[model samples]
Target: MIEEIRIDNLGVITRAHVELGPGLTVLTGETGAGKTMVLTALSLLLGGKADPATVRRGAASAAVEGRVLLPGDAPAVARAAEAGAELDDDGSLLLVRTVGAGSDGVAGRSRAYVGGRSVPQAVLADLAEALVTVHGQADQARLRSPAHQREALDAFVGEAHRDTLARYRAAWAERARVVEELDDLVARTQERAREAELLRLGLAEVERVDPQPGEDVALAEEADRLSHAEDLRAAASGAHEALAGEADASGDALAATEVVDRAKRLLEQAGGHDQALAALATRVAEAGYLLADVAAELSSYMEDLQADPLRLEAVQQRRAALAQLTRSYGSDVAQVLAWAEDAGRRLLDLDGGDQRLDDLRARVHELDEAVAALAADLTQGRTEAASRLAAAVSAELSGLAMAGAELQVTVEPAEPGPYGADRVEMLLVPHAGAPARPLGKGASGGELSRVMLAIEVTLATAPDSGAARPGTFVFDEVDAGVGGRAAIEVGRRLADVARSAQVLVVTHLAQVAAFADRHLVVTKSTADGVDVVTESDVRLVTDEARVRELARMLSGQDDSEAARTHAAELLELSTVGR
Candidate 1:
């Protein structure tokens, strides 16, 4: 239920506050009384497209705000919470839309807010849809939509099969998913084969190299040893020749170790004269032992220095293999190992048989059966509810001076569609003697309005209609093509709906105006400019004023005594219902 609506600087409505309450609250005024403006303002609040031209002449912006009391567990609350909005315990959601302020043109400058948080226009639209359902002359035509048909049928069935519908939907989704996967696989079967071959080739190439961690570093060291073998051999030979005895010697053939040994012996004899000299002689002897060991090792290395061509070839080959692996797989040995592991996993998936394919096919078949079953169940419920729905709508049509007008709900399977197997169409027979036809086929504008009202009245009385409907419902010129008793009945119907929901009606019918809970007369007032004012100026209308307004509607005159008396009688009757 919408608690209130406030419109500011919008079209002919400079400022107006509509205190809305549960049930039918009617708005009626003279021609161009801003009644339509009220509905337009509501449409804007519900996320309708914004136009700058709708702003009042002197105002920079137009704004509409509403308070919607929704169900505590409504899906909207979860969405609001996800958007980081706070919800009151009473389940009231505040919505506000402001358009074309200073420096803010149409486009990104326009803004909407929910629960005190600024939100995108799209979010506001979604929130509005979740809370309120607006039905205009155009909206009533939407009852023909297949989705709406299914929903209405489901609502009429009540809670008995809600869970069944849920199950059906879940099954349908799964079936759709598997079918999609099957299509993808069929499209890519050849590509998968090529991919498998490519993967196999890559794995074989990597395996042949058999790269190991730290192997690259060790191979490089060995390659260096083999590359410099000739130079190393020559250097060792020269050192050995100098340390050991050579075939020809220039001054003396004594090794340096012999000279150090001689000094050690002389120092041992002179130890008593200088202790420091004896210690120095001991260090020289240790140096002689180290020198002798290196000299012997050099001699052995020289003996073993034959450059084997085979060994060099092997070292170069191993180094080349490591280089190739590094270039293809990674910057280092570790990365190549990681690539190999990943490739192995992909290979397993590719080579595995059609187990997944078979599973998908079976699951799709299973879901199709479930969907058919649910569609059948839905069809059954609609069949049962349609007769009652028809009777209820026909009864409403009778009051609108359309007695004998027949209403029918036709449910049948549509082409296999996203909403599943059902299509529904509403039919009408406007004349008592004529055959029933689709509502669009047999009804005139006034007839359509009455038929639409009848249908709406029927749906409203359904247990779930209130829960499923948008918060506000607007009827634009529903009383346009009817008069006399018919006009009075239209007024009564509008009043009746207001008792269950917020209703705004635009009309030129005095009978309709008389039924309004709050009657506002929109009139053009010329001060500095022509300003549109509500009946607010004529507050507490005397019998004379009431007659004047009714007379204007009835006879196009502002003053008529007879019209005044009739208007007062109608008002008295409407008030008595209160």
Candidate 2:
């Protein structure tokens, strides 16, 4: 519950502080006395839109602050903490909003704070959604919206419908996901088939050639050797003839092996006289052995060397085939092999497109059934709740001086949506035998106000069953066109609602004002000059002062003896059943 509200430089309020407590707290004053400004200040603190035009004349800014005491486990308390707002020692939260006007034609700036910590205005708004619900003429206008009507019906249904709604929403979300996947697969059927075909062709080509790693380089080297086979054989034969005697050469062409053998024999003959000569002879013998080994290798090489054009052509053709694969798939045989491996895996996936599509379609069908079932449950719950809620509100209306009037809550099947497969609407049956019509179209402004009040009272008085209710309920001009016993009933119902929560009403009716546990009067004071700014002051009025205020509201004359007596009697009647 909001403990207090402070307003400064707001409208004609200038500066005002109002203390609010449990039960019905009524604000009364003459027209244009800034009574509505109190609600506007509360709206600002609740993160409502800020209008610079509301700033008091000659003031640069307007500010509103509220102190709210909440239970430790209240939803708003946790929400405020989540936004980094601190709770006071007494577990009260402070909410502040400031709207500042810029110089002359500049736009205004608005800021919001919670528990002395600056936060986004939206954070304050979210917290306020769970803390207070303000009803005024504008809210009555909202009753015409189908969405709002559905929301009201759902809220009236309480936990059972909420549970079914949650389940329906979950099923609907999954169904949407499955449908999306199915659609995507269906749309890509032709594309996936084409991709698979391309992959198949590429993989078939790679399999036919069957290129090996490093095969391209090895083939190139072999081709070069084969192309120069005759030249290489001729060079090896010449070297062999120089190292060992040629078969058709003259004897004077001494071979390297014979020369080194002769040197070794001469050195051995001299070795008997010196050890150094013996070592020189061993070196010459090693040289003769190396020469002989070279001669043998050259002879074998000439025999093995050959020039086969057919084989060379085969190598060239094979190389051209590998090059083609490389051009289309990769830079070389190794890269082409890598591409083939990857494409093979991708081909598997693309080829299974039909199977995946079948699976998704089957899943979508199952989810659709689940969602339909849940939607049916939700619709049934809402239909039942709507009937009960309508009866309850209708009963409330009968007590508010509309005994013959009835509220009809209609729940009809609608196309499946995120919410459910039901459309809820509120209709008003003004009197006996009157045809039921939509609220705004069938009810007068005064009737609409009463209807809204009735609905609020019914909902507030209903058993909570553990659901959180907004701590504060504000009604601005809720008694707009109500009078006599009807106005008194409105006040009495507001007080009834207040028994469970805090309620504040801005009213002009003396009957309603007289029922308040606390009465505040907003009075305007004019300066000496007619053009001077008018100031509005809000103060608690009690005892004779409160009686005089009620008298002015009753007859426009606070000093009238008859009006005073009537005011006193009305006050006395308001407390008759307390």
RMSD of each: 4.7, 6.7
Minimal lDDT window, size 10, model 2: 527-536
**Which residue pairs of candidate 2 clash?**
none
Tens-place lDDT per residue, model 1, 1-578, is 67777888888777777766665555555556677777887887778888777777778888898887777777777777776667667888888889874544433246888888888778767777776656666754655454564576666556665666667778778788889998888687788778888878877877898888888888787777778888989898777666654434565546666666777888878876999988988898898788788889997887776677898798789878878877987887788788878878977876662666777778788878888888788667677777877777788888788888878788777765545576776788886888887755666777877776766666666554422555566677777678888888888887877776666666778888777765545554555667664324324234666667777777676666676677777788766744
* Residue 243 error, candidate 1, Å: 10
Tens-digit lDDT string for candidate 2 (118-222): 999998889889999899988888978888888887777777768878888888888898888888888888988888999999999999999998999999999
lDDT of each: 0.72, 0.87
**Quality of model 1 by C-alpha lDDT:** 0.72
- TM-scores for every predicted model: 0.81, 0.77
Q: After superposition, how far is residue 162 of candidate 2 from its true place, in Å?
A: 0.7
TM accuracy, model 2: 0.77
